[model samples]
Target: MKQQLVFATNNPHKVAEIQQQLGDRYAFLSLQDIGCTAEIPETGRTLEENARLKARYVVDHHGRDCFSEDTGLEVYALEGAPGVDTAHYAGPQRNAKENNDKLLSALGDRKDRLACFRTVICLVQNGQEYFFEGKCDGRIATYPTGDGGFGYDPVFIPDEGNGRSFSQMSTEEKIAISHRSRAMVQLEAHLKKQSDVARPTA
Candidate 1:
């Protein structure tokens, strides 16, 4: 039987991305599917802290093995202004277009557009917590392009993507090189190890 895990999120885009990356290794469910309607608070100072907060909330309230991730776009020029507040950089409204415009405006005519996408994943299982992290180096685009991805995908171009924004790439292409994909790879490996250890030695 496939292992069951709860992903502490309601974003269908995120759920689809993760499901594609993880394949058939585990069965995944979102908080809404499990009847969790309350907004899970993300009141941490960093990505790891926020991930832990969400994962812990799901485990505590739902009593299930759960995992959560927090992603950020850190721009060297902006002094990481949106590191922990990437989702609400523009305001509490969490408008993606506004946030993108704000970032581009803040950049102005600066030649250096160095930035990185970072993701922190926290898994809570059987009262234990595990964390995984991944980073993808890239530069912010002056204008948003493509419509295939969510969040900063339209304006963030990964170094390995051959100058194409994440939104321009197919889901498979993005999954192969995204920060979240890298973190999920590590988490999968850890879970596989744990499963092996728990198996009976016949």
Candidate 2:
């Protein structure tokens, strides 16, 4: 029998991406499937804390396996102003364009162009918690490039992936080198180990 996993997220886009990454090995369910309507408050001070909180919350409430992730953009030039508040960097409304523009403006006349994206995945199984982290370093472009990605993807030029920013690459390409993807690789390893331990011996 397959194990059930809950993805602690309400965003349709995030849910879809995670599903593709994790594949069919596990039975993944979104928050909607578990009848979770209460707002998951992000009171944590950092991405690592937030990710763990979400995963543990869902698992405790639903009594099932669950996972969650928190990602953030840290601009070296801006002293990481949006390090922990990438979700609402611009304002409470969460306008992607506005957030991008605000960051660009704050970085006026800065030639450093150094930045990084950090992602942390938190896993909760039977009340046990685990964490994995991944980082992608790159330079921020002076202007937006492609329209493929949402939020600040147009302005984030990854260290490798392609000449253009993440917004220019397809989903497959993005996942190949994304910070989240790296973290997911670690997560996959963790799950594989669990599967081995749970397997019956001859």
Candidate 3:
């Protein structure tokens, strides 16, 4: 039997990406699936804190194994202006286009375009907590290009990419090297270790 776990997020894109990356090792549950409709607050000052807050909220409220992740695009030139506020960088509306526009305007012809995407995942199971982090070095584009991805994907180009934005890449290609993907890889390994320890020796 597959172990059941709740992914503490309502974002379809994120849920889909994670589910695709995790495969069949676990049976994933969504907030809607478990009747959790309350808006979870993200009052943390950092990605790790926010991820932990969300995961803890689900585990405490639902009493179930749950995981949450927080991702940010930190631009070196901008002095990491959007590190923890990536979603609401522009305003409280959380509009992706506005956020991207604001980021580009903030850069405003500066030559230093170094940036990185970072993701932190927090998992809470049986009152035990774990964290995994991943980061992808990249540069911010002058303008948004592709329309395939959400958030800063259109304006962010990974260091290992072929000069194309993440939005330009196929989902399979993006998942192969995304910050979230890297974090999920670590999570998979940890879960496997826990499973092995719990298995009965013959």
Candidate 4:
């Protein structure tokens, strides 16, 4: 039987991406699946803090083993101005196009386009918390491209993507080298170790 785990998110798309990454090693549940309707607060100053806040909320309120992740597109030129505020970078509305536009405008003709996508995942199990982090180094494009991804995907090109933005690639291609995928890999390894420890030695 697969170990059941709760992922602190209501978006089925996000859950699906993770399921694809982790395979059938575990049965993943979303916030809706666990009947959690409360909007978990993410009032943290950093990616790790935000992830921890969400994961801790689930453990405290729902009493479940849950995990949450926070991702940010940090640009070297911008000095990571929107690290924790990646979602609402443009305004309180959290408009993706506006945010991308703001990013591009701020970067206006700057020679340095170096950036990286970072993801921090916080896992709360049995009342204990653990963190896993991953980063994908890349650079921002001069203009937005592609129509397949959301947020900064259209303007960010991975170092290994052969000059193509994430939005230009298929879902499988993006996840294969995404920051979230790297973090998930670590989380899966940790869980596997714990499972092995819990298994009976016949």
lDDT per residue as tens, model 2, 1-202 = 6667788888776766667777787777888889998788788999999998888788778777888999999998788868889989999888989999988898987899899999999998767888999999997888999878677899999989656799999888888888888998898899899889998999
CA lDDT of each prediction against the hidden true structure: 0.93, 0.86, 0.92, 0.91
TM-score of 4: 0.95
User: Tell me, what's the RMSD of every candidate?
Assistant: 0.9, 1.4, 1.0, 1.2
TM-score of 3: 0.97
lDDT of 1 by residue, 1-202 (tens): 8788899999999889988998888889999998999988989999999999999998888888899999999999999978999999999898989999999999988999999999999999888999999999999998999989998899999999999999999999999999999999999999999999999999
TM-score, candidate number 1: 0.97
Best by lDDT: 1
Candidate 4 RMSD to the real structure: 1.2
Candidate 4 ranges with C-alpha deviation above 4 Å: none
Candidate 4: Cα lDDT at 176: 92
Instruction: Let me know the TM-score candidate 2 reaches against the reference structure.
Output: 0.94
lDDT of 4 by residue, 1-202 (tens): 9889999988666787899888888899888888999978889999999999999888888889899999999998899867899989999888989999999999999999999999999999877889999999999999999998788999999998999999999989999999999999999999989989998999
TM-scores vs. true structure, each candidate: 0.97, 0.94, 0.97, 0.95
The better candidate by lDDT, 1 or 4, is 1
Stretches off by above 4 angstroms in model 2 are: none
Candidate 4's displacement at residue 118, Å, is 0.4
